[model samples]
Target: MRNIYLIISREYLERVRKKSFIIVTLLMPILMIAMMVAPSLMMLYSKSEQKQVVVIDRSGVVADNLYESAEATFIREDGMSKSEACNIYNEESGIFGILYIGEVVDARDSVQLITNSSSSMLLEESISSQIEAIVEREKLKEYNIENLDEILAKIETNIELATFVNNGATEDDGEMESTSTGVSYILGIVLGMLLYMIIILYGQMVLTSVVEEKASRVIDVMVTSCTPFQLMMGKIIGIAAVALTQIAIWALLVLSASKFVMPMLFTPDIASTSGALLDGALGTVTDTGYIATLFAYLALFILGGFLLYASLYAASGSAVDSIQDSQQYNTVIMLPIILSMIIMMTVFNDPNSPIAFWCSMIPFTSPIVMIARIPFGIPTWEIVTSLVILYLTFIAMTYLAAKIFRVGIFMHGKRTSWRELWLWLKE
Candidate 1:
């Protein structure tokens, strides 16, 4: 027990103190912040650059009604022909394109946009929408509808939807749980991605650590002091501690940035929209109970999922003499994780489907799938059952992997096979 504790301490301190760990731990949150901020900045820049478009309206009825905005200005052709306008427009630096509203028997098919460079879809859509609006207005006037604007205004409606869940209660006896579909979707995806990345990243780290030790013959000396299972457990636990620490730091940095820095960085409209997006992604930020439940599930799945994969990774590392040789074995471990990610997209669309339910219960996939379903409120029995199955699978896998690790650590200069692994397990 003391030896295992000592090994765990050694592994934990060694990794956390490394330059690579320090650099990555600091850099990841900055990268996440950059990812969030860059798109909004690009959008502002794109909107700021005004585009000049020449309108050559052969159909005179549409020219007077063409809309102009800050992003684009429509220049009406006076007496110049289409070819003359194209030539003059091509010479201008800021001009985006030319819109030719040809004789419109059908507005959709007849309107054409010509540009010297690639055409902008936004510009094309705006022009088409304006022309369609004008055509509709003219048809209404021909029909002698005097209050067309008022009628249209009265008919245009915006709908808001509210969702609620019954919390273990009948309609007469229990309170309703208010929720948002957008919030659940964003949370599920975000949590699912986090699980996928953490498992892949740290699981590989465990594998590499074992391979490095075995390659250097450090495991040969360590085996004289402790059993292979102890060494494996120590390594898994130590690296898990490192993962948790890094996650905590990242969460803190993200929280701080969202609360303090985002307002200063973005305009009021952008900031408000961003805030709404974040709230939708995370649920109500002020709801302590919900937030606590989320973190608990996250911790449970991350730990279970990491241990399950880490055991196999450790076994694979023990079997290989070099990183290159590890590739074939690594592929075996990676396939399920990749498959789970692919299936996650389907889960996002219908969390209550049978496929989602079974996937969440399956040990190999439950860690990601179950975490995704939790934000939307899965059954309590399902969560408990999934956790039990995952932990039991983790134990079985660790035991099987220990059999391989026990023999494979001393192996060298030869490739391992499935038959040999089975023999080791039996022995």
Candidate 2:
């Protein structure tokens, strides 16, 4: 126990003192904050320069109704052939494009828009809608409807649906307000991605540290003072401390930026333009209880998931002499993580589905899949069961990995195989 404590202290201090660790810990939060803010900033600064488009209307019915906006200016052409217009108009002369409206036999296929480059879909849609409105008005006039615009306005409907959750109780007021479906899906995806990245990033760091020590024969010198299992545990726990520290710093940075910086940067106009993206990203801060629960689950799963995979990674490092040789074995560890990420889409679509439930229950995938489900609200029993299974699996895998690590550390000048690993484990 004393030897393990020494090892843990050494490993933890060695990594946290490194330049790379400090750089990554500070840089990551800045990058995350930038990702959240940059889009809104771009939208705030974005100016839509008005485009000049020439309109040649053969039908003469739609021209009077075609209006201009800040995005585009409409220039009507009379007695100009398409060939003549194309020959004279230069993109350098500030003519964005030309819209040639032929006889409207079918509005969908008859309208042709020619541009110097590819036309904007938004511009095309706007033009098409205006023409359609004109046609509708003409048809209504033919029917002798005196108040066509007023009747159309009266018929238009914009419905806003309010969402609520019903808490099953005998009380009169059982319904509580719930988040939108989009908000829920976004939360799940973001949390799932966070889990996946942390595990992969720090887990790979553990694997690399083991490989470096083995390649340098540092393990041989260290083993004189401690057992293989003690060394492995020490390394895993120490690196976990580093991960937690980095995470905490990132959390503080994000909180500070969202609370102080974002307000100064995001005006009402910018927030309106960004719509729900900025809202959803910052919404978690308002719900302190939810945030607490989220971090709790994150902490639990990250520790279990990291320890489980870190053990295998340490064993993989011990079995091999070089980083190049670790590839074949690394695939074995990575495949399950990849599968979990792919299946996360299913969780987003239906969190209560059997696939999501089983995936969350499975130790290999539970770290990611379970975190994905937690944001929307998961049962207490399920969270407990998943955590229990994950930690138990970690313990078992650590023991198995230790068996391999004990023998593999002394191996040299030979390639390892599954048969050899099995022999090591059994012994």
Tens-digit lDDT string for candidate 2 (387-419): 999999999999999999989888876889989
* lDDT for residue 416 in candidate 2, whole number 0-100: 94
Candidate 1 lDDT trough over 10 residues, lowest sum:
277-286
Q: Return the clash pairs for model 1, or none.
A: none
Clashing pairs in model 2? none
- Judged by whole-model lDDT over C-alpha atoms, candidate 2 comes out at 0.79
Shift in Å, residue 142, candidate 2: 4.7
Deviation in Å, model 2, residue 129 alpha carbon: 3.3
TM agreement with the true structure for every prediction: 0.82, 0.85
Q: For model 1, how many clashes?
A: 0
Scanning candidate 2 in windows of ten residues, the lowest lDDT window is 278-287
Off by over 4 Å in 1: 34-48, 91-93, 105-108, 153-191, 258-296, 351-353, 371-385
Error of 1 at 395 (Å): 1.4
lDDT tens digits, residue span 93-150, model 1 = 5677777877772556577777877766676677777777788877778888878889
lDDT of 1: 0.80
User: What's the CA error at residue 168 for candidate 2, in Å?
Assistant: 9.4
